[model samples]
Target: MKQQLPKNFKPKALAALIGLTFTLNHASTIAQEAEPETALETITVTAQKRTQNLQEVPVSVTAFTGDEMAEAVIKDMYDLQTNVPGLGAFQSQSATNSSFSIRGVGTSSQNFGLESSVGLYVDGVYRARQNSMINNLVDVAAVEVLRGPQGTLFGKNTPSGAILVSTVTPSHDGGDSFVEATVGNYGLVNLSGATSISAIEDVLAFRVTAFGSQRDGTIDSVGNGSETGKNLLNDRNRWGARVQALYTPNDDVSVRIIADYADIDEICCGAPVQLSNATINPDGEIGSDLALPLLGGTVFAGGDAFYDREVAVSFLPESTMTDKGLSAEVDWELDENYTLVSISAYRNFESFDNIDTDFTDANLFGTYNDSKQSSFSQEIRIDYTGDNLNYILGAYYFTQDLDLDYSLYTDTFFNEFYMSSLGGALDDLFAGINAISAATGGAVAPVADAAPAGTGFDHQAKQQHESYAVFGQFDYELSDTLTLTAGLRYTDETKDLVTIFSENLADGSQSPEFFNSTTELIIGAGAAGVAAGNIGAALAGGQAPSAEDLAALLPFQTAGWGFQ
Candidate 1:
């Protein structure tokens, strides 16, 4: 080559060879680097009663894994709304009064007769009560929020949406444990832990999870004498524990048993009073100002009530809830493409709320409510998986018994407020009754009590609900990415309620005759009076009146008694 080389041919050939070698080396390096270390995670969900990839499900749903929830600091159902669009959840003065709404449709009524529009299911067991729906999530595997009517899959009272929660399944592989702690402002402290162990190697496993949290109240309680204190309203105190056991007798059959208990005891929910222009009376004086003397000159926070976070409550608001349940789930693989599942569960819930109805330093009125429910349910389903078609057929049975004891009472200040508002008319009436009694030689009891302190009504109610349903859904694939779906559910339900009412006097005596006569007179006056009488009767009978009843009675009572 050095002796017989064309002038430029040798140089050009050398350069082309070097360039080809460098291109080959660069392509080899890119091939090696393009190989990914990990692949994207695939999410699985059970929205259609069968495990399927999230992207494959046709329903409008949002899902979150345990790690995601922990990362977002989601502790309870109320925190779910922060991540779920068009979903709203609120815990009122008590967990028993919690509400969940989807797309602006929900049942906010605190009536036991009404069920939630948005259904809640945990580990495939339906939770019918709001009190049971607010428990802290522990050792959770996943949560799915399905929007729009889910009645076909979930049964009754799911016209709005559904929430599905799945707990971690104990593994027979090895032992794992974790503990987490959190601290924040307002004396917040949270501790949670989980432990899983293989009990019988490849055959049986067990898991335990527990959590507890406490935090100071956001609203300050001030200027309420002995009732004044920090963290007296809207505080948080709760704890829960769950135990699970899994038995895999063989590859084709498996069984899981779970038991859980949760409790919440806290002070909650007092609203600061705010006066607006509409509160001005005909005399150009703020309506609330008329009761300033009765309230002992106590002033709620001025300006924005929420920003101020100050309330003048004579009694500390109290809310307590307890929930416990046991469930057993069995899965049997019928064949390569079919599976059978059976679930049986029993649950109990109890809650109590003592609230300052007047929301003022003055002990005018208050409420005490104690509620309990026990429920049992059983479900069986068969799932079939086919290349071009999938379907689920299920039958469900559920029954529950509910009992409630409720009361309303007022103190001396209530009578005083009424008397002053009526310009001493109550005093005059009492005097007239005394004179009549004196003339009758005590034959007529001198309206002795004059609706004294602790005078109100007690209501007791019992309700039983039973339901049976058969539901089925199917998905048929028409193409690789397009599918047709259809579902149907038929339900038969029966409900029974028994309510008893009784009135209480200052001396704690029943006055059914007096109450009935007074209620009749009030009913004759107008619709408002009729509603108040009914509410009063409900209270006297020891029944928990609905919020609507209370709201209707509040204005009527306030206007008639001259104090709110």
Candidate 2:
């Protein structure tokens, strides 16, 4: 599916074509009239961890240079994925969360602890999480997307593929600066630019770049005091900056250091619900539809109608994300045919999400969540190239600390769960009581009373992962048109994790009034109600349901809720 990035990602590169219309026409005419064997633009990439001609590599790789990407208006990883065949990237239920897939292989959504199927690397240093890879695409250099499993070369988490990104190095050329801005409908505003300068000519150079964009959100959040425009839900606001320093003290040695930070705040991912006549939930139970009549059912956001981009949520929406990193790379020429390389990097990222989950104007359910990932990686490698043989060997070490916590709240879950949990008991009690009223020629119903049974989730988990690997790869040219390639890696990994999950009633417990009503409803149901006795006696006898009782009564409630 070629889904256009939501309205927020629209490109403003139209200005680049301003003075090229006639020139391009002339170039096209001349090229078409020239020799059939005219040369094409050359594209170079480091997909194999070395500079190489794109056509010479056997692996399936797509390479785009920094200049080419800017010209093509590819702003970020998500935009890059849109142009690649066999690549899929989409925002998950939260703006701060996203998923990627290549060639039908993809990572599941919002599973913070699971490793990505595709690996991500910046300047040869591996990144621990994919969420940290999508933003702040600035500076220079290139990106190489290698398809299929990079089993040996990249090590773990590459069963699907790998993405290699390189930022531009300091240039010795004279400095240049420019400012560009785009304003469009729907309050779309984008501004970005860069400046590069040489402090000591060929000896040292530095660059600074920044980008920011803001636009009206996609979904309109209405009802429950939601402002029509000021507090619009699903809005987009993001900005980031990067600075780089490059040093080349001698012809055989070069070093580059990069530091960057990015932040985003937005109300994103508004999910609306639609009503259906289906009689059952996927579990084969009569489902919540069975309780719809009693609960009065959910009210659609548009008051019985669903309009385009309209969402109703009783809870406010919010999402915040931040990323920071530092990296250093050095290349040293040891001799004529040999070279040494080292890459070290550190990164920290955090995201917070507040979502209105019930998908209605009524207060029902929602969630507050946070995830943080910080990691460090170091690698050193030696390269040798010869007429018939080329090889590289490297050692890598990586470590990470991850923390995630989620709080899921449901204001109406008590009714839903209790109905599902004590369906027979409630029916037994209420049936008899209603029958008693029926004999008096009157009907009685439930009120805003009793122990509402909703249980929320409080989960906090910590995970520590450490990995080390030694790997080598070689390529041999047997003849003019024949070649051989082989690679191997020895790896060790250790991981430790702990998580805590609980669910409880909103009213705290079986309040006395709730018990009285419950007993009365049971009595109304006839036989079973009479045997249960007065509410006081049953309660005093410790007859309230226990966690074990709930386990047996509400099988679906076993999942999670409460504090960890």
Candidate 3:
């Protein structure tokens, strides 16, 4: 309305209208502000020692939360392959150790002088042995699989990668506890129980966890269909517990102690069944024995005589393992920006008479060998860490003393017995030849040589090794998005190898030298005894056999009886 009202009337009416407008707009603004927040949540992880967004960490890492572990059925590092890419695990049937490969770089050698490319650590304490590293890994807060050379911050010999396992620490508030049980295929059963007690309110606390698992075997014996052998190639019954006590007298100072023990009785069985046996061809001609044959006894047609049979056997023993250890550490906050920490640990592990790897041929015509090993390890380290630039300066001293014994049981008796038996049969043929020669009016040949006698090879070797290593690693962040890592280690390895040989000689004085010169040569020469003697004498005198010489000796030595 363009019409002007009395000044008082207009002011009163406008004021009322403005008041109504303010209330409506204020309500609408409040309604708009009350709408819920619509942004996704961000996750933080301690992959670099400091808390940072998971996606922001520059290095490649795979983190598994406790819940994720359960979902994936991951019980330990050996179960890590299901979730982690480019990683695989294999346990040794001949030793109390495991092989972990990352990008195909892990070591397959179980020698005391060698170190694994993949490093394993629990609660910051390095696990020196493979069996010990498989200790009860339950109740873990998270597991971080650090890929690439982790030599920078995690210590030495991690040229391939590293696995860091962290357990849940005790709560300062009045403690809590839980119990759970699980069962699976092949009679699998597992039980775990834990409780935390506030020993001294917020000043001190203790947490204890116990667990057990058992399962039936998965393999059925192929030879005799017997259930007597270990069924599960990797089946085991395990039980263990851990006690961790923490004391925080003040917010600035703290001390912690940890003790653990575990027993693992497993039947490890695995064999490498793939191999190639290469041999030299007899001659340069295409018709030589090296060439593939054809039928109907002709070069162009395939035949049954061309086929060869190949048989292979494996020799490995079942293995069992046990482990126990104790450790402690102290953390002192020197200031908000600086802190110092000291860590000390002690460990003892013994494989006992656990593994037996004698899976070879024990027949009269084959070979058999027995092998076993025992090893002990000890280690100690000290280090430090901080902000912006996080670095660990430490000294690691490691020592291992190991012993290995082996023996070979050959069929020497059977070899000798069979050769004599075969020689008797061959001798009967010689008499027939003499009669045939007399009737035909041809010259009769003398006796043919006997075949080479039993057990062609035999020997044994034993070795002991003592080794030590001192190592360290350094990690530095150049910027907010990039990091530079470097490390080096020195290892001292020593081995004492001994070889012992034996044979069932009727008179202990018989050796390969005497046997080969007389018995072996005579029998192997067959009907060519006289010609072979001359040829052998010429060879002994350093004279080579020429084509002409071979041709001249063929009929007497190799051709007449189809003996070539």
Give the candidate number with the greatest lDDT. 1
The best-first sequence of candidates by TM-score reads 1, 2, 3
Question: Against the hidden reference, what TM-scores do the models get?
Answer: 0.80, 0.77, 0.60
Worst 10 residues of 3 by lDDT: 21-30
Give the range where candidate 2 is weakest over 10 consecutive residues by summed lDDT.
Answer: 21-30
Instruction: Give residue 177's lDDT in candidate 3 (0 to 100).
Output: 60
lDDT of each: 0.71, 0.65, 0.51
The numbered model that scores best in TM-score is 1
What C-alpha lDDT does candidate 3 achieve relative to the native structure? Answer: 0.51
lDDT of 2 by residue, 404-495 (tens): 98877666544554455555555554554344335434422222223343545568899999999999999999998988999999999999
Pick the winner on TM-score between candidates 1 and 3.
Answer: 1
Cα deviation in Å at residue 281, candidate 1? Answer: 14
RMSD of each predicted structure:
17.8, 8.3, 20.6
Model 2 bad stretches (over 4 Å): 1-37, 175-177, 223-231, 272-307, 412-455, 504-531, 534-564
**If both were scored by lDDT, which would come out higher, candidate 1 or candidate 3?**
1
Superpose all Cα atoms of candidate 1 onto the true structure and report the RMSD in Å to 1 decimal. 17.8
